[model samples]
Target: MTANNATPPAPPVPSDAVGEGLKAAFRFHPAGVAIITATTDRGPSGLTASSVSSVAIDPAAIMFSVTRATGSAGAILDADSFIVHLIDGEHAELAQNFAVSGAERFTEAQGWTMRETGEPYLPAARVALRCQTLHTVTVGSSVVVIAQVLEVIEGTRGEPVVYLDRAFHSVATA
Candidate 1:
């Protein structure tokens, strides 16, 4: 309250402070892990993402954000379709591999295979959603992608993998 008995105006927040605050807030928020793969002109490209979320049910739409539209992210943005693999704790190594830059990807040991439709698929994932990109919106340095789920491929079920506090964790069921 001010001397006049009126509410005081809030101080303006710096852009960097807002960004850091958001990062800190999300660091404590648990998010599901997903490996997104696509076929590019160079070869197969993929990356681990924690932002995959369902947007619609009837059209089966989903969305995820990429901080940079390069490497696997660039390939995904350029490609018409891609695969979103919902991974579990058993595939944590695979998720880490994709998350790292210049890491060996799509290796035979990783159980990665190309579907006839041309997108890279990971059979080890608990569930794989074949998606066709519907739109992309640029938000600062990040690109938010909205895709339509074309097919749902079910695989072996297990404890789900989540990311929190900068690490991978497995959720135990009751």
Candidate 2:
């Protein structure tokens, strides 16, 4: 290894095959919806994310990926802190607002607050997690962030907001 700690070269791949494999290889299970928000000097920003998951419970960590081009990513890079709000069915409008990229989101939200670290939180979320950036890895156009959960707020009882088959679902049995 070099003193500079540069990564070793990777072997060459055949044309287009690896790309196609990547497109079809990974089929993930259904996941719940969450909003990852960060506070930056410019302002608070966030995205409607369906990728939130617990990586470990013992160490209290979770992982989510954000497109490098996502507005929230730019804020996260600056603030180095964030929060993940697990949405409930009551937040359908909230999810829609967050999913809409660009422009102001927090301006219209009623129960949102910016934490000291510049992360955004919602009083209505089923679960709100304050996070410290533990690790970040680049994968193509996205950055995978694994955060150490610092603070956890458990909400009053409610149904979970879920996403499956490209549709929104609630955990409350009908």
Candidate 3:
């Protein structure tokens, strides 16, 4: 068929079906859970996330997606920096706290603190990555935030918290 050079024809599908079919076709993949935190003028706020991932290494960039309306969103935006706490296997409570909605999320523990900018992060996590926001992109109902690593705190190397198929899994150590 001869093709027009002006524009490409759009593929056709039921509008609402896109969202529904997407959830089914999405094969659940296991991912480590983390609590990303940043300080807000209202106090501190954060949320539990399993979508955090490493994006680049030369500039030490990482990416994580959070819901657009999440309380943590405003705080992270306000501070312009954050700390990603890769929780160890023993931190189910902390995970639950950050996963739930409330004002007490910031005060759940005594040791969570920022490195240089006073952003909140769990001191006892398997790894604590302090990052400054570099870019943001909107996808679906969330925002993909790309951050530049500022510093890192290495703690007890243990089984990190993993989420798979809507449940928690433990990482095996060799």
Candidate 4:
């Protein structure tokens, strides 16, 4: 068949199926865990994120995606700056608290504090990256945020946590 007359390729797989397949595949893939927090006009907001990744080093940049532009995600998007807490297994409960909608967050018992710049900070994190929002891109149902890491706050070190098979797991030195 000629270029313009060539038969069309088979229909793409339905998004629902593709999504399920993607989730299934990722269930076996381990990802480091982080909790992103920010201060908004209303109050403090944050969420657990497994999508955080380093984008650059010299300039110190990081990228993460929020599935919805509402709740803590919305607050983070609107904030001028935020903190990405690199948490360890000891903070798994805190991670779950942030991940769940309407869960009590920033509670005094959670060891949350406000940074001088006003961003919510977690002193218990293995490391906290204070970042200023640099750019954002909307892709499908997710908003991808790229931020410039302004400062790195070191905290207690322990076994790093990872998300895999819908659960938090600790990684120990081999």
Candidate 5:
């Protein structure tokens, strides 16, 4: 059979199917959970993200994506800076509080304090990074935010929270 005369092309994958497939593929890949917090005129807001990654070392930059519809997205996009709190196994509840919409994130109950630019930093996090927003790019359904690290606070040493297989897991030290 000739090139064009061979078999017919396969049908395009459905968007929902593609989304489900992507989710399944990522479920096995463990990722560190973090809460990206920013100050809004209304108050403090934040969201949990497993996509945070270090981008550069010289300037100490990190990147993470946030859905446009998230309550904290507006504040994060508009603010000059924000805080990235690396959640640990002990603080998974804190991560869940921010993961969902309309949760009281920065109240006294959560035990947080304001950072340099008014961003909330969790005192119980394994590591807290204060970063200044450097660049933001809209990709697909999320905005990719790049920030420069302004300061870092080392919290209680422990196993960092890892999300895998639709659940949170922490590895024990040997």
Candidate 6:
């Protein structure tokens, strides 16, 4: 077959590819870690996310995805707004706590507080952005949320937490 008319080889079937292989492929890429938090009737809820990204600067918007049907989904979906926190190396325990299937994410001992709208916020985050959900699209097992940053809260500055090679590392300031 001529190059222009040649049919491309069929894409590899996903089922034929091992899940671990896909995961391992992405393991080489490093991503900044953050925690997404919201408050619902049940209580404060959160999850650790490495998929957070700034979608736009003029509008000051950000986007992140969360697994559908998860505990934090309802809180984030029902609320008009939520908080995204940039975690540092020292907050690995906090990240792991929120990463679990069912864990007490926000305890009184952690000193979490609520905004005027009642959404919970973590005070110790390296940086916090209060965002208003603008749009959402469901893709596969995840819901991608795009939000406009309504407020920015600066916190303790230092090394940032990053996830890579299935482990967490601190970005060096120097």
TM-scores for every predicted model: 0.89, 0.78, 0.83, 0.89, 0.85, 0.84
Which lDDT tens digits does candidate 6 get at residues 1-174? Answer: 234546788768677367778777889899999888888778777888899999998899999888887877768877777899988887777788888876666776765777786777778778899999999888778898899999999978757778998789877777
Q: Write the per-residue lDDT of candidate 5 for residues 1-174, one digit (tens) a residue.
A: 234746788769568889888888998999999988888787887888999999999899999988898668888888777889888888888888888766666777778888756888887788999888888888677898889999988988667678988789877666
Candidate number that wins on TM-score, 2 or 6: 6
Candidate 6 stretches with Cα past 4 Å from truth are 1-13, 16-20
Clashes of 5: 0
Model 4 spans with C-alpha error above 4 angstroms: 1-14
**Shift in Å, residue 77, candidate 5:** 1.2
Model 3: CA > 4 A from native: 1-14, 25-27, 108-110, 114-116, 172-174
What tens digits encode model 4's per-residue C-alpha lDDT throughout 12-95? Answer: 857888989988998999999999999889888889999999999978999999987568899999898899999999999889
Clashing pairs in 3: none
Clash pairs (backbone) in predicted model 6: none
Clashes of each: 0, 1, 0, 0, 0, 0
Per-residue lDDT of candidate 2, residues 3-76 (tens digit): 45467567595568888775455433456888778877787788888878899987899998888886667787
Query: What shift in Å separates residue 8 of candidate 3 from its native position after superposition?
Result: 4.4
**lDDT, model 2:** 0.76
lDDT of 4 at 146: 92
Candidate 4, residue 36: lDDT:
95
Model 2: lowest-lDDT 10 consecutive positions: 22-31
